[model samples]
Target: MDSSVSSLTQYGSFRKPTFPLSNSCRHKPRRWPLALRFIKGAIHHVILVPILLHTLFTCIIVYIHINIQTLSVPANIVPSLSIVVGLMLVFRNSSSYDRYWGGRTNLQSIGTSVRNLTRSFLVCGPDRDEADRKETEKVVKVLVGMLYAVKNHLRSTWGHGYLLPEYKGLLPEGMYGFESEGVGLVLELAVVVERYIKRGVDRGAFNAPQSSMLSSQLNALVDAYGKMETIKLTPIPIAHQIHQKQVLALYCCVLPFCLVDELGWLCVPIICLICFMLYGIEGIGEEIEDPFGSDKNDIKIDAIIEDLRQEVSVLLDSWRRGGEEYTI
Candidate 1:
């Protein structure tokens, strides 16, 4: 038992420290009470503006109907309006969700391609000589750099802020030919990888089939990059967005008028609840539509990038150990 414990301790000493998972499934739970949650979201500038306007309109309609007896909008009008507004909100949320899901899917594709290409380079490529090993290490660094660059590209952030500290020295000194630093860096890395492949083939380190597979993986990464760019640059139709907002605004502004005659003093709370629900739904769609941002609801891009880095590190370590060869 003592010998076993000693061995375990020795093994533990060489083990890497484990990090807490940061993906969606293991994210910190939100445990705020219902009242707190309501108050927290209620005070947001977006919701507050609509709530204040709703309250004002509710009070005005109540006074006018009870004291002056001058206004009465038919209650039947609400059913049709509610149906139309509900449908529009549904469409809006669905379209936004499509974009959010597409962004996530594309990012995953990029991550998969990065891992595949990195593994192919480190395990299958030529690492026979000291010079060959050095070149392979350089290529591995470039693979890691491409993942970070893609993350920054999606977020529309350029310059050094988004770069991984460990891989910074591996990248070129300045942005590549393109004006956009993130994209330019990725393109530059691709050029380097392609040239490395050509040199490997010329030196007979990798034959045609092996070189072709590596090139295909690189091509997959680029294809995923283009798809992500399309999602980022193209937005839902402006007309649809504008029209939905206009409808929502009109519905909220006129809502109290319809309720005041029936609910009297109770109309205020009812209107507040209805406005909150509708506004909250709309807000969710807006927040998620561009999932690459820093918002709580946005995709956890930093976490994803960190996972990619860890994956590449593991592959590099395996190569260094001369582990069982990995076939493409």
Candidate 2:
């Protein structure tokens, strides 16, 4: 922490933070959910659900079509010959990934918001008076507090309950915590600002433009909270789910017909391999949809948020004491 005020303003540094940005913390397998076969929903699934329902549905249809049409080769091979099914599977897969990528774009917004907010703090005013110093101190504390709160909140954990020593006393006393721990801490800090502004008005420290700017910054902080929450709560629509399942199922059902002759009984393993590829893709998609989930692909909100709080606190403490002030 540096109490030795930087030549740089808070807004300047935040707008372009030297620090790394936070990202979701987990990873999930790409395979489609195994239970997808059991679950109903995808459009491809609807087509294959009937096909899968009747065990020999493909065999019976192929057997009859091949025999009736005067074909010499076995009937099982008839069902697997449609190259279009394979093509369609590829199309479904690409579409699913597009959805996943879209979500990533939204998460990036939170990072930008943090950078901007930090810059605002960096460029803002400073003072030597006890009251001004105390006001500044309160705002700085909240800045650190919000980061820690948001990180843990996104993880839906109270890791902040122990990890961040700086914000320990500032939190609510009971259960039912925030969506993001860092966000909660920031709000607490914002409350302090509002109090300070009211006090400043009485004492005549803040002028018209200064007060307006401060209020705007506070609003931006609150908006950041809403945006993160929006990302957490409103993920991709569930309809694509049913469509993806259908495509994977259809791809699997046709595999046996495609390789029955050359592989014979070995067709089972070959077919299983094919299913693995399709299922894996689907599974990974599900894991990433809600980046905040427990899946490995998730954004590690706890670690990132906690780190932010610590970093901000460290900066302020160093500036406050003009040395390595708050020792761990």
Q: Scored by CA lDDT, what does every candidate get?
A: 0.77, 0.53
Predicted structure 1: lDDT: 0.77
Q: Which pairs clash in the backbone of model 1?
A: none
lDDT of 2: 0.53
lDDT of 1 by residue, 1-328 (tens): 8866885585457657755343434556669865677544343556778877887888888888889885658888888889989999999899889988988898888888888877777766776788888788888877878887777777766655234464565564553446353245577788988999999898887899989988998898888878878878888789988998999989987777777878997998898888888988888777777788866677887788777776676567657766453212
Candidate number achieving the greatest TM-score relative to the actual structure: 1
- TM-scores, all models, native as reference: 0.86, 0.58
In model 2, where do residues sit more than 4 Å from their true spots?
A: 1-128, 157-189, 194-207, 322-328
- Model 1 lDDT-worst window of ten: 175-184
Model 1 Cα shift for residue 4 (angstroms): 12
